[model samples]
Target: MTSRNTRHHTVLAAAIATATAAALMGTALTASAAPRPTAGSGRPAAAPVALSAAARTGLLRTARAGLARTAEDIGLGAKEKLVVKDVVKDADGTVHTRYERTYEGLPVLGGDLVVHTSESGRTEGVTRASKATLKLATLTPRIAATTAQKQALGLAKDKGSAKATTDRAPRKVVWAAGGKPVLAYETVIGGFQDDGTPSRLHVVTDAATGKKLFQYQSIETGVGNTLYSGKVDLATAHSGSSYTLTDDTRGGHKTYDLDHKQDGTGTLFSQDNDTWGDGKTTNAATAGADAAYGAQATWDFYKDTFGRSGIKNDGKAAYSRVHYGNAYVNAFWDDSCFCMTYGDGTNDSDPLTSLDVAGHEMSHGVTSNTAGLEYSGESGGLNEATSDIMGTGVEFAANNSADPGDYLIGEKIDINGDGKPLRYMDKPSKDGGSADYWTSSVGGEDVHYSSGVANHFFYLLAEGSGAKTIGGVDYDSPTKDGSTVTGIGRAKALQIWYKALTSYFTSTTDYADARKGTLSAATDLYGADSAEYKAVEAAWTGVDVH
Candidate 1:
């Protein structure tokens, strides 16, 4: 995540996302898959458990067929229509289908929901982003759409945005997160930030009152490179005797050189040889190699650890852009481009393309596609924390000897010349700006700081409190309530968090909701009375989220 700017992304329906949402039914629906060795993890992927094309299609059909009844059960009006966003299935035959709602053909912000059902299609529960009843007195706006766009651009310029403007006009949407649903305008502005980072700010304005509802940067911070990871194997493509950074095996993911510019995809890296770098940053291929490795590792981590094929689970690869802006100290993930961009760090010597950084940024795409967490407040904090948690999981799963997995973010990137990490998961408060526990005002803090709560909980649950050494990294995580807690393995904790994120989380899920969702996920994976379930409860309490 951009610790400075934040890890927030906008919701843009890419070609693949649109196709999957409206994909037609297929045949032989089942949960069987051919075993494939994971290049990132070196283990057989969890493909057998992941939903196959047939399975996804069948579930989508079932969900679409029952959409009307599901809306009625959830107390929605006749004008509301459900569009399937994603489908997750467990080995026990439980299904969780996520859907985006529309009111009279206008997209509804914070109208996302997840429907849970049993193997026999019996309703289990439903998670809604907004509990407010849907009823719009009128659809016509009092103000002009051009006015909304102008206001949004003005707001962006006020925030130090250069060349602030939008190519398309503001689109009508229903805002229903914190209060009653109302007609609103969503304006997306493109430009450059004060730091020369690419700008993609989203502004939501109330149509009737001409009041701004919300504004956020869609360029979520994220990276890779020979700068950190030592010599590593990369899935490169060969064309006409030249090897390119394009990886065909893993969703055709490619790495490009931005050539120190702020925008646009630069040149693709190609060489006569596949071996990339000599463990240094001077060679341009060094960062390219790292980015390729990071992408492969992250892809492998998700596919091997959770059976997720890709960020969207559509067997598609998101590309990478490096060498962005001279001395650009930050890296980010842009959902609009479906790519991760890295900047050459201080003096162009330190590239921010560390393994964990890449995992962290790409995980933002995962959150954007799944939970669709808004990039502000408590939900925003969880969004950031989700990246840290999963990014750490990616680092560990990589088992890279050059850069051992640690419970720290951006450690090797050396954003600060003194060799300090961007954030600490074991003791997030160590960073001074981050909160180690939950509080009423936690939601008011910057997402990067408030994220300390969930990050601490994961640390306590996985490694427990007090002194410990893992992968040559020393950690002394503490509990908020001064209570001694027992440790659950990282595998179990990661699984629980992933399940909660996919099956239970919504756009507006706060820390309190997070506690309940994780508990429910644990109950589904393990028994309600199992030790793992109890540990999840204890971990939440230790973080003061109870």
Candidate 2:
């Protein structure tokens, strides 16, 4: 269900980055990003790629070679090790290599950093998630791992349904996120959350102190197209005088039916006719069409806009599953199966299969693959906001007349029964549960509601501050300091965000880190003196992230 979120190949977009886009030396960084057409401008983006395989390999090699000196500068213990996680480059040949730290080979939570260097391998500056020097007195845990696992599962069962379970027992990790670094156990709980959404809750407990340290759910609420595209052509495969919802061009992406059940991939949709959906929830084909189309559009958006291959940035595509359960009301993306699942809403009348919803859910995959932002605190808010931002981008990129791009999310689904959207970007606070500005307590709220801050920031960055009507919808956006902000256009905003997510952001990146990462990304893409950079600063200020 995306209202919330395709492709033409080779000649697809004129302004987006392609899979083979070369690294052309530019003022922004190293990779070239041709200007993209703004939303509702009836244009598409199909520019060059981010960085070639050789460039990425070179960046990683440079980062690893200088790891000893870089770790020493950060005051790390001799036992600490740095491993390059991902590498991205700029148009000016600047490379940002993300690294994860390990203390005595034990994973260190919140101990990730991005090392920025010039094309000549000269180290510039480092953005560290945590600056703590990890050196524990002992590796043994006073509390048994089984004890921690039981405690975590018990808590998950409390927050989850009766069937709540854990796939793996608690494992040891260095909890360096807050205060002093301590040995802790990280437990992952799976099953349906209390609200019926699938859960990937991570619970961290102190091994020495016998106290729970942290817990977060990775599968938050967030997946497409036939139901929304309105008589559009589908890129399906032909099989024995029939058609199947299998797209080989986009990594053989397929759509399945859960058959009103809660488990498994269900069945693949097939028929004599290639056409799918009537834009109504009358048959199973309608929802299948929507889901398949959503997947296609999302794939195209990433490929054309950012030159992203797929959710994992590999050529492989993630599958989609619909008709998940009876009256399930919500849809979600699950990483365990690398697929999406949807529900039948309101006595199974509404499928929760809106275009934006599909885009929102699938964007969760994008977040998981890139920054892997922790699904808690300010970072979780950013995660949700990223989905909303990308979902909006998906709508615009599709350029569907029946559902043209808008700042409202889930507007077509009638989720609230009052024809109100699940969220509003221009003025997120208008939804009543979201925050309009950043606050210390924002982290404690639900990720969906706390996402309002980043959502408002993106809105200001792309649309500006004040009252206006866009896509036939009314909006009145305000600022924390009552200062006016100008938009830098959605196309540029998307570039800065994608660059930041892939390069500067880490798993524990909070709102503060997001502001910094995006500012740096803007500087890398448009230069420090450009209006886009200034607008990014102003937008974050408007959201009170400063």
Candidate 3:
């Protein structure tokens, strides 16, 4: 984690400037270029292979175990019905798996839940399944990219003829991090070629060592401009929004609103040659800045804490658009883009573009991309709590000289219409009707407020019981048992939360389930009997969750 003093505004300002300028031309710029085909340009054919009966049964068992573990880490209960319907094996012995399950009795089905098992029968990898494969086999892409290298190549934008004359070829290789190989690529885009071609060379690198592995010219696709928009759609598919309408009320500036010309929900506004949050904004500049900061913060939080990068560990960059619509009152994460949006408050004065709010909103993307948490009841509370935890982690990561880390959300955005933070972790009830602890009735309330129990637990896990100052804010968090619970600090706490989120939680997580997830995650990160583990267990107890 970055120190508060060294980070904060400078890093945020840099991210904003970079993101805003990067968005001006609407082109993709990756760290590397795609590797050219070493063999034939024509599509390759797959060789047929077959699996034995024993192999089939073994693979199915492995898949079931992987699904169970994933569900457990994601806060989905053990009884959520992780059932494997069929398992098919190809000539290479690679397996295609399908399953049917229910989250609180909601029938759900998915496929291609790939699992790699070692000789000892221990699961090695569990990749996310494609919805199309799970929903309809015919809908799956015929040439779907499978490996990390293929995925990285698929993510880059076409650079056109400018890259054709590139004397430099992109390097390609797998970089090792935490014992796993990560595919990395690097390249320049939008630059002039020797012949003045309107393209740039893509460079690929080893994600672990930053080593250049390969380089290649991106094939120009005239539809390049639509690529980002398409990616945005793919990222936000799970998020319930139809379109992103820019807010141009004041001038040419914009706010990425939900629909074209929709009123009442637009988030930020532009004013006085500057972007301020007053419920409406003109462009994605300032809100983009806040979004960039929050995105980077959450990204860094996961990476530095748990050794993961971006949302997919694939070196993917987050997309953020500002100035949503006229007088919008909220910001949101559209799963289709794996990006977040901000809004100026009603009438365009208070933009919900604060760093904490940005983190809060962006975390939703992270959660969606990871656990696919359901958005109702106990699971909903866990989903909300996950956002709050990561949002606080972002503040802590900023280590900003101006805005420090604390238990408050939206302190800078002034969401309350007063000079106060939106929500308080120390005394969550400060949010008017937020619950302070777990109760049966809590599930019936709003997901945000009912999330207090988990939020309070996270705060206590990071800061312990005491009156202290952090990032210029004062907090005197208490314990339900009145027993001092020594925490593992914010950095480690954030790590545990993220691990639990990506590895342990499901859409049905509640307070008690959260307690188990963090504890298990702590044990996994540290040792089962380590101080960190004990602290996590105690922290939940302190919040009356254990």
Candidate 4:
């Protein structure tokens, strides 16, 4: 169900430090005064905070109350009802709480804002994603719901069943795509597409005119069974004589079975004893083990490498659901449920739950919470690339013996059943669908294929151009201009990428912006004139991103 248009992500900080007394004293700040620069524009830098364990707990406990007062202090209209979505407490005790707005009881799609608070319980600044006022002409739509549903169905790519089904009535929402709020009908169309892909299309149409405004498929497809990564240690909880598949060490991440259903969590994996599974798909526990291991490894990679507490950076682990749907051939990260779902492959023999696939899926959650790169155009490609890059990083970080790290993605999963990997980083175009270099039309390509540009840039930045060998795998990366770029090593490359993603890149950021962001990140981590910074610049140039 993954589409090029889906969008969501974690937080990126933009600090505006004005005296707290001024804000408390009722100083008027216009909406434009809120931090709204594209992520990585390098304005209003965020200040890191360090808070003790006890202080962090206390701050979270009072965050909701503070949000209400802060909303008023920040000039929010009385009608704007802000619902807190996430709260992040930095090490320095600065808390950034994300909020979604609703007007007259209808959800405001683009009116998300974040309120920053200091350790002393004072408002520091606010970062708003939408500057549009949420005043609509009317809540009731002139277009009938039936007509809207018909329009939505007409626009759907998959009209498998002459009539698409919806779970509920079309909801009224404020469409804010062009930075102005418009009364619209948000419709969900569920069915199978012409290409056999599952569809959970979310369509937004103008309520007054019935004109289509926006649409994106909600089903994210990306998974596995008998333990793909081989024998691995698992953290389990024992209650009486049965053990559950919950990892206490990694934020209590649990694995569940969807039992061939497309909706709801099926069952928590449990057994009578510690002995989990044989190396075969017949045993469901085997698939659960692989999923659990993947989550654990990915969690450890983020924590140990980037110092991120977890996927949300709040030390809260996202659970994993395996065996989702019947003979399904994909895996996805759903931010709404805050969990990862993996489907049993075409025949249930190849569950798409390999390490890299798991890493890739979970990284989507990371991207959703960070830059939230819009899943379309160049930004979408970068979003997919972020997942691939981080997934590869997790693989390398794990250094697992059975499934050793390689630049190839999903190599062991046999996703195509042809013994060929899903993608190759060194020569991305080798797959026949990916672009080896960037072009003006690159944004028009599928996100998975267009991701090659950034993937290539990362490869060149980390391992340089031309032939090389690492971890028993061979790679020959080519540059656009046939120039030989020197390596900055993967460690430094990962640091720059992570920093750029979390601190700089925004939803609308493109390839050019990515180049600038990585450079800024490199400058922050290394000297502006350091070799690592130079390498980053050269790598982007090598990918024709300049």
Candidate 5:
């Protein structure tokens, strides 16, 4: 989810054919150099596991009991009481219960953790984002709410437009960073930025000293395009006299028009007829049509490819809002509303409503429900990359000629006004800002640019290292280690990545953890010594993640 424009242009000359042949030869040589093992190459297929009735009841009872025993069960201090936030029982009979910590009736900000238990109530493991103990000197804040609010507003003004407004009151909470916990006030400020970008800033300030603790923007921006998807059939609900943009096939997913407004659910799109759009932005229904079609395709892709029911796997669809803000240049998926919002690009003629963009934004919801990756640092990079990878997978799965699948992200949007993509998976550094490979300092880079490491790894794992044509798009990938990689094909590659994301990844997983997670996933799906597993290892090594 990178909206930053790129100035570099990719030159795809006819000489790529020769490079493609050489790359293929290198891959062949690499494969010949190390023959694959066959003994542990495949696993016996097993049926999906299910939780027993007694296990479900036990988990429910544990959840309803305030989860107070979790502290002792998971080896926490007596002062730490975990409140259950969510309880998810996996198909393998593993119960994962998420919790938030409160110390002496005060909430701990970074004290959230997930406890994994077996069906027999045996503790398996725990995943915690912070290792620091929740101990604070005082519960009362020295700073007044009014002063905190003013400080937050001033900070927002410094980073945003002059017209930005702050209307919400500050909230008191514990600020936890670097293993230290202190009383703090959380302030939220929202409005349009000076550059016309939307802002949803969350600022934290120390309540005792009035020092700024941290700040993060809630608005996640990325790039898209309407403006064309060819003539296609749409799923609409027919009322007495008109058709509504609701798809019954996909849990009644609907598309709405925000009419340049920023908040609340907009109006449902309806018309007397089913036909929509003329491949132009002049018609309002045109953007809605593209949105509806994109949602349908994304829904079908997830269900057909991964057997996932919906974003939460709850057999429910998330709605979409189009034409958000005036000349808005981005789109985002907000979990608070459980919906996706699109904006009209510069001048209102370029709406950010495309198939892959839809998939990308929706995948964020999927990631939230699954791994719950924290949106910062290396984990944040992984979060963004997961969307890009899965979104690209959806595009290929759709196989639509109007928007053929490619590794190039936001290619149709012209977000940079140069007709180049926002990112290039084969060689991410081509975007100028993105990293070509992983490094020790990668976590310090912007999540969008740090995401390039994983994107490059996925490209190598799926298509190998060299020049290749996929979905009518040419890609020339190079390895950081100058080693040739033999791909396991996109299908198998996507399978491994999905398995890792849903089953193994956690909120604080880094690049090294990701390598282990993907390898373990490949082993589970393929085998411990399978070619796919070896390829996963090689691909990570190619990205300098080892």
Candidate 6:
């Protein structure tokens, strides 16, 4: 999902003006021979009408229609809209576009769209809209470079990363979670942080299967490396336990232990990054809380929707590592560990660790183990959209008051540095340069923003009719045919997309592949002639993908 696309965001105004002139006139006109039309001109002899609120909205709708290739391609849900403004011509008299919108408390930087023209007034050659969010500053190097000071503070990448070597020594007796006899490996990780903190650990293994059953990392709490120090007591009745040791002056020494008891369900391991304002308790607490919510959402989306257990379909226990790589701005899943990681922001610790962000990262693991979608071109876009679709479903499944279900991504994380949602499903271009539907050129942009086409398709498939409000948000979507649209709801749309991701999609998939996949998935869920199928087709058609 991190793969880069080549679609640059810079837009030339002269090109757009030429395109507008071509679209307005019946024939091509040389720049030297044609008289320039003024902005806001409704006639062919005049420049294209100055972009108004209505016109901007219309342009987004048109883009959706042009790019969409299936029912799943026009699925922009309500509660989101693309707002474009601040259009200016460069010294070369070429037009470059920018947009402004607020999310949470920050402003989002949108991409640029360039316009090119043919001789006829008929519009042609509108090309190259670039992504704007790249403007966000890079993550802080200090946080990424510094290691956790103590064994308690550090959550190793995995037990394997911290495994001790058997120097042909005799086997050592290790105690299991129940304090029973077992074989174990013991070791110490020195130079834990720049300040010379150390990590002590013991890992127990299943002699028969060679599988790791338990890992214990010590917790140390102190003041400037001279205070309270001790091993954290993490009592585990079942599989294992984890603890984060902190040096708190107010409380002296503290350890937060996560243990597995004879309980109904165990903890989930998944990491999602976020840059918040705090480096200690508050931020850590939020990561813990988000992890819990994310696990629940993932389980619900799969179980309630598809009747599947955790990622492995065998109820495999997963782990999550938070505060990875200092001020890390993005979250991702590592296949080797089958876990997720999160990071804090550079400017204000605005952690990218939102609910959707968590789901998105974890879904990447799912995709990797399943479709193994190559993160480039059409397959790449599908991969990104798959994360988004499921991620959105996870948000809606939670149905929380703080973060209501919507089609928007990063609405809570403030990833834009300005408080604005990262992308709009109804119109991906609101973030500037994002194609609302499938485009041959889609494979040419950044995966983060290029994902807009598929995101829009999902929105359209779920909510066919435009200009309606759902789940407490307003969306004024327009259909390609100017017909009313209807949605099959986010829940159903996710079911279809997941089924497609795991069972239908391949490395070369594009918009057409997505269309067939969803239709088949819908037929499997609802009858072939069911309203769901009808809605899917209608939604696709609304975006000009029938």
Query: Clashes per prediction?
Result: 3, 44, 86, 24, 0, 78
Ranking, TM-score, top scorer first: 1, 2, 5, 4, 3, 6
Q: Which tens-of-lDDT digit does each residue in 224-298 have in candidate 6?
A: 110011111121122234323221211111222123121112233222322211223244544544543455456
Per residue, candidate 3 scores C-alpha lDDT tens digits across 211-237 of 443342221100001100110101111
In model 6, the worst 10-residue window by lDDT is: 11-20
Best by TM-score: 1
Candidate 5 local lDDT, 1-546, one digit each (tens): 455552111111000000000000100000001121232423212101233445545666777584767688877777778776545564445566766677777666656566766667777666564555667778888989888888878887887545667746788877653346778887878775554545666677789999877665555654122356777788889989998999988888999999988777999988787787677898888899888888888888777766666776656799999988888777787666788888888798788788788888888888777666655667767877888898899888888888899898888777677788888999999988898898878877777888899999999999999888876688999998899999998877887787677655655567887887787567656667778889999999999988
Candidate 2 at 230: error in angstroms? 0.8
What is the lDDT, from 0 to 100, of the residue 319 in candidate 5? 97
CA RMSD per model (angstroms)? 6.6, 7.9, 21.3, 7.9, 8.8, 24.7
lDDT of 4 at 518: 80
- Which stretches of candidate 2 lie above 4 Å from their native place? 1-48, 51-76, 223-225
Q: What lDDT is reached at residue 139 by model 2?
A: 91
How much is 521 displaced in model 2, in angstroms? 1.7
Per-residue accuracy of model 4 over 1-546 as CA lDDT, tens digit each:
122222121111011110111011111112211221222422112322333345546655676666567668877777777766555554344456656677777787655555656668677665554555666767778889888788777777444433466744588887654456788888887765443334566777889999877666554555123467888778888999999998888888999988887677879998788867787888888888888888999999887776676887777899999887776666777776788887777688878788888888888888777656666667667878888898899899888888888899878776666788877898898876788899988888777878899999999999999998888888999999999999888877887888667655555566876887787666655656678779998999899988
RMSD of 5: 8.8
Where model 6 places Cα greater than 4 Å from the true spot, the runs are: 1-283
What TM-score would every model get versus the actual structure? 0.91, 0.87, 0.54, 0.79, 0.84, 0.51
Q: Regarding lDDT, does 1 or 5 come out ahead?
A: 1
Order of models, best lDDT first: 1, 2, 5, 4, 3, 6
lDDT of 1 by residue, 24-43 (tens): 11111122112222324332
Which segments of model 1 are wrong by more than 4 Å? 2-48, 223-225
